[model samples]
Target: MWIVLMAESYDRLKKRAQNRRSDAEEAAKYIFDIPEDMLSDLSDDDDDNDPDFLSPEDLDDVDANTEPSDDYSVETPPSSHQQQPEPTASTGKSKKKLKVQEKFGWRKVEIKKVDLSWKGEPRQVPGILETPLKYFQKFFDDELLELIVEQSNLFALQTEGCNLCLTVEELKVFMSIILLLGVIKVPYYRMHWEAATRYPKISDKMGRQRFAKIKRFLHFNDNSKAKKSGEQGFDKLYKIRPVLGHIRSKFLEVTPEENHSIDEQMILSRGEAA
Candidate 1:
C-alpha cells in the first residue's frame, strides 16, 4: 500500500510541473516578440527532459535580444542633443542601456577666453623707409649670395664637368627674372623669350640658354655629401637646408610683429614634395 501511495504522489508532482511549464511557455509566446524560428527552438514535447527545458535565464536572454515596442515615451536629456525613449517599468533591459549611455556620455559645458601678454619689446628697423632692395638685402646679404654662387659652380663642375661661371651680378638678374615670372604667368619658361610674347625686361636681361643652364645647375647645398634616405641625419630638404638655416638665423635678428600671419608655398623641381 505504501509503495502504491508513493507512486501516486510522484505522478501528481509530474502533472503539476507539466501544467506550470505549459502556462509559462504560453505566456512567453505572447509577451515576447520572438521569431517563429526561435519559437521552434524553445518548443519541446517532453516536459520531463532537462536539456530541452527553458529556464528563467533563457527567457531573460530572449527578452533582451527582442526589439522594443513602439509605445514607449520619448525623452530628451538636458545635455544630449539626441532624443531617446524612456523605458517603461517592464523594460529592465532598456533601463540598463540608458544607464550605460548616461555613464559615458559627456560634453563641454562652458568655455572661457584667455589673454596672453607679450614679454618682448617692440622691434624697430632703422632706415626701413629706404629703398625696398636695402630692406631685402637685410635678409639676403652678400654672404648668402656668394655662397649660392660657390654651390652653383661646384655642383656644375662635380656633375657636368663644366664651368657655370655664375657670378653674383648674374645671379641677381636671374632672381629678378624669377620674381617677374611669378607676376606674369607663363606655361613655359622659354615662352618669355618667344617673339609673340616677349618682355624686354626679361628677354634683354639674360639669354634664354644661359638662364636654362643656371636654373639646371643651381644649388644651395652640396648634393655630393647629402645624407641618403633611411640614414641618420638625413634631411627632407637636403638641397635647401643650408639656405633655410641661414634664413632662420636672419629671422632671429629682427623682432616679429605681435599680431601677424605667414603663408608659404614650396614648389619642387625634381624629387618628392616635402
Candidate 2:
C-alpha cells in the first residue's frame, strides 16, 4: 500500500512541473499587433490588386522570410523639399539623401606693447679713480708687472714639449718685439722682425718663438686671483677688468655739456674693426 502511495505522489509532482514550464514559456512569447485605426491612412483600394501584396493569413508566416509587400505604405507629411526620384531608383532603391550644413564664427583678441620707461631717479654709484693712466697703473704697477713676468716664466717652463723655452733677457727682447709690432706692418716671420727695417736707428730684434710665447701667456691680470661681483650674469672682461673699470670711471667722472654729440667713422679702411 505504501509503494502505491509513493508512485501516485511522483506522478503528481511530474504534472506540476510540466504546468510550471508551460507558464514560463507563455510569459516569454509576445506579439505586437498594430490597431486598424493607426494604419487607416496607409490603406489603399488597389492593395488587393497588387501582385506582391500578402493577405493577413500569410503575414502569420512572416518569420519564414516572406518577401515584403510592394504596396506597404507609411503616412509621411508632404514636404516641398522632397524631389522626384530619377530613373536610377526605378530599379527599386532610394536615390536621394539630404545633407545639413554647418557654420563657424570666430572672435579675435587684442595685443598691446609693454611699457619699459624708467619710473624714478636711477641709483647712483660712488666715484673712485681719476685719470685713465692712474687706473692702468693701479692694475699694472711695478710689482704686479714683475709678477706677471714671473708667472709667464713659470707657465713657459710648464709648457708641453720644448716650445717657447726662454731666459729672462730673451723674454724682455720678445716684449720689445711685440711693442714694435703694434706700429710696424711686419708679418710675424722671425727673419722679418730680426732683419734691418726701414728705421736703421731702432736696435735689437728677437725670434718669433719668444714673441709667440709672450703673446700666449700674456694676461692683463691674474685670472686665478680675480674677484667676482655678487650679481648674476655679471660679466666684465676677465683679462681687462681693471682697464674697463678705469674707462667706466673716466666716463662717470665727466660732467658733459648739455649739448652732446655722437660721431662714428672709419679710420685706415676699417669701420667696425677700428
Candidate 3:
C-alpha cells in the first residue's frame, strides 16, 4: 500500500526515463569529443605541494567559513568580500518571472471564437431559415390553398378565441382575394380583398385576429397522436406544415436526367438545438 502510494504516475515515469536516456546520450557524445591530451593531463601522480598547484595558505580566505572535506576534492564556500549586490524589487520579480517562463516553456495562445450572431447581411453566411421566406410564392397551388382555407375556417369556428365564423365557400373566396392582394397592391387594406369577393362587408373583413387564428390552427397532417404523445422537433412541424414530405418522397422516387446543385442549411436560434 505504501509503495503504491509513493509510486509515480505512468506519464511521469515515462517522461523521466526519456530524460535519463537523452542525458546519457548527450554525456556519451561529450566524452567521445574529449581529446586524448585532456584525459592524460588528469594524472594521479600530481603532487599537492607542486608550485603550479594552489596551496592551503592561498585558499585560507575561501576555507575560513567552510569545513575541510575528507576527500581530495575541495568544496569552497562563497567569499564574504565577493558577495553579490542585493537585487531591486522590480528587477528581481522580472528575472524570476522570466526564469519561470523559460523553465516551463509555455506559450500564451489566444483563440478567437466563431461569431454566429446574425448580421442580416453577407457578413455572416445565410441559410434557409435566415434567408427571406419564399414559400408562399414558390409552392402555393390553387388546390392546396383552397384546402388550407377550408380546414383553417373549420378549426377557427371550433377554437375559443380569434374565431373566423365563415363557411368553406366564403373562406375560399376570402383566401383567393387575399392571396391576389400580394401580387396586386391596393390602398384599401382588408377592404381591398373583401370588395373583390361577393361577400357582404357587414362583418369584420379578414381582420388581424382572424388571420392569426387561421395561422395558429392550420394543419396538413393528422397530429392527434403527436399532441397526445407530447411530440417535439420536426414532429411538431406536422401540425402546421403541408404534405411536404410526400412531395420530397415523390421527387426522390423520380430519376432526374438533369443535374442540379443544392446548398446545405442549418437552423440556429436562441435555445434551438440541432
Off by over 4 Å in 2: 1-144, 150-176, 189-191, 194-205, 222-236, 246-274
Tell me the whole-model lDDT of each prediction, alpha carbons only: 0.81, 0.55, 0.52
Candidate 3 ranges with C-alpha deviation above 4 Å: 1-139, 161-210, 222-227, 230-237, 240-242, 249-255, 264-274
Between the candidate structures 2 and 3, which one is better when assessed by lDDT? 2
Residue-wise lDDT of candidate 2 within 168-207, one digit each (tens)? Answer: 5554555555556567655544435455543332233644
Worst 10 residues of 1 by lDDT: 94-103
Pairs with backbone N, CA or C atoms under 3 Å apart (clashes), candidate 3: none
Q: What's the true lDDT of residue 27 in model 2?
A: 24
Runs of candidate 1 exceeding 4 Å displacement: 1-115, 122-128, 261-274
**Residue 110, model 3, lDDT:** 97
Sort the candidates on TM-score, descending order.
1, 2, 3
Model 3 per-residue lDDT tens digits across residues 157-260: 55554555545555554565566557666565444436464233422455545654555676554433345445354464666556575456545754443334
Q: What is the lDDT of residue 121 in candidate 2?
A: 56
Model 2, position 240, has a per-residue lDDT of 68
